[model samples]
Target: MSTDAHPTPEGAQSGRGRAPDTEWRSWHARRLETITAPYGPLSLTGTHWLDDHPDGRIPAVPGVWVQDGEEIVLTAAAADGLTHDGELLSGSVRLTAHHGPIPESPLAHGDRRLVVLRREGLRAVRDFDPHAAARSAFQGIEATPYDPRWALPGRFRPYPEQLSVRVRSADGRERGLGLSGEVVFAYDGAERTLRAVVEGDGSLGIVFADATSGDTSYRFRFLRPFAPAADGTVTVDLNRALLPPCAFAGHFICPFPPPGNTLGFAVPAGERRLIGG
Candidate 1:
């Protein structure tokens, strides 16, 4: 592993600080490797909504999939060679939308599973084909190792009223980017805060970019600030920053950074670029 810190003009001022500890740097590197792996977010091929196919059949996916308002009806013959929850499935099953991890999805056929999903009444099916082209073409992710200066202690301040903003996604669609508060921290004596949306589990998500955007790193990156403590203290660890869905497949409707979310500063501390070779 390379412990060296390369200069990034975007966040150059912040990069001049001391890097994080060796153990933390190694952990950050390994995390990047796992996220850029074959089955990582970069490997996602498509997010097919059931509403697009009025006929219960999704293109390229062999199972009969239809959403029946509240539940998804998937019809597959025993010979279709699909699996559900790791077991071979050959019959019709009524499946509800899964809101958990992809690997633990309740529907599958062999290596291909029909994932049922719903967003604001619009139903969709995510096809996780292990043989996806993106998965095969994945070389690795370009990232910066952890630096203590980049992992600043932050405070979560909830808004008096929740804020929602509609932003254009990479797929040319508009989606609501909700914000409940901001996580404020300081780097190089300069205070910075990110507009964050609280998740169902109370975790916070920030869609942001820095000088490295469209230059060294992907256009934009995502950062998840773990749930705040009783005292509202949190750690904004840029080392664990992530690439958005649009970074993997073009089909994803990932929203861009809302106003004020994009820091004018350059963040030169986390995942830096994409290694395609």
Candidate 2:
């Protein structure tokens, strides 16, 4: 997770020689398990930006969260039924900006985790409750089975300097999304490019859309490309493309595709939508 922003996702890796179908099945099953977990994306109920509520009272959430310069002041009285680091918390506590695994977060209300996050100098609190309706009703993600044709080869061209561009988020607010380079490749006899961002682990993150978006698939999806090889050659495997967090929960402010990140053709492979529509 980002100290100043929320992180993306997790997936399983396979050995180089593993059968594609078997590996894909394993990966898909794990993905389902992860999303249905206690604090997974489907369990997220809300992300209340503190700036939206000057009084520090977030809807359906307990605690008074106010931003003070570089920190978030969370005043949870005994009646709030909140805890910090496992002990019942009373009075007020100052919190630093961080968003990661729910268990690692310092604040909680019973089975729900209160994730304090700060992005671009803005603060927010994400509520992750195990009993969220979406998680309980989740059947699985509707993904196309592994198909060799959907996996394409590409080359990573890094920029001389990283740049940040403001893009609209799912929450209807514009936030700066860092773009470090582009992934160029041939798809169906046409050359295409996707804006790429450098992830914390040195991998490339692609948030994009295609013709199928908003019709067959979610509005946008994420493709996590492994760190480039020394020669800059990499595989732009769409078979492993993932549905962004916002697909599971509306509260997630997942960023939309940056300019030029939308593919013109339909991409029928990869995760389409969550089960049960």
Candidate 3:
């Protein structure tokens, strides 16, 4: 069967390959809206460190926040309209920077939510407001129509063990990039493979580019294939290639593709670039 006929399961449609003409255009329109959403990466105004405020009070955030051991203590009043653990919490509550999804976050103060964060040994708070200017300016994501030619079957070859390599960040910082293995696949009669990292949820995230990158699209695009099977085989579908967080939020520390991840041919499919520059 063709990749477009990959079959849509019961609840969710198959996210692989190109959508039919009607659905394909609709998906492209929605993609633009998602990338340009209010809380999207572009609107990040500040990332405040708790250490910066010795007194534990962040400016513009209506609460008294202090670090207590591994948790952060937030003190607010009923008038502050803060909610925590499903209750309109007043006084104080201890919180840890949530490692889970943003929708389930427990700490909120009216339109603003205090998101605890940790990087290295440093602790900080992320403030999310629905009224953020970025959210308002969002139009939508720019993506190319899904094409089966970009979808290809691939095999996963594991290394001896997990390997960590250092790469320079867009922010001029060096960080560790971990690799589990390489995903080898064929596209346009050419065999190609890319080094990828396995997400905690078992998805495969690859940073790559083709001859079209830097000219047709951004310097690089991201591809997230579903988790591999027990035998270590997965689909390296370029149809669903994506843009990195750095493309949205400047504060994000995104890793660059290693030397070998770049494909020599132009793979002109999926999200090409954002609109309006």
Task: Name the best candidate (by lDDT).
Answer: 2
Residue pairs whose backbone atoms clash in candidate 2 = none
* Pairs that collide, model 3: 31-141, 32-140, 32-141, 33-140, 36-138, 38-135
Please give the CA lDDT of all the candidate structures: 0.69, 0.83, 0.68
Question: Which is better, 1 or 2, measured by lDDT?
Answer: 2
Q: For every model in order, what is the number of clashing pairs?
A: 10, 0, 6
**lDDT of each residue in 1-277, candidate 1, tens digit only:** 0000111111111222344466455555555555554444554567788877888887767678877779888888778777776667678788887755556787765565456766667777777666778776766677776666677799999999998888777767776777889999887778888888776556677788887898888988877666888898998988766676667667566778888878777888666666872
Instruction: Give Cα distance to truth, residue 1, candidate 2, Å.
Output: 8.3
Give TM per candidate. 0.81, 0.94, 0.76
Candidate ranking under lDDT, highest first, comes to 2, 1, 3
Tell me the lDDT of model 1 at 15.
Answer: 23
As a whole number from 0 to 100, the lDDT of residue 265 in candidate 2 is 96
Using lDDT as the yardstick, the better of models 1 and 3 is 1
Put down candidate 3 lDDT per residue, 96-193, tens digits, no spaces.
87765444578776656566887555677876666776666655556777776666889988888988777666556666777888999986677888
Which residue pairs in model 1 clash with each other?
A: 10-266, 20-147, 20-148, 82-109, 82-110, 83-108, 83-109, 83-110, 143-271, 143-272
Which residue window of length 10 is worst by lDDT in model 1?
1-10
Return the lDDT, model 3, position 11.
10
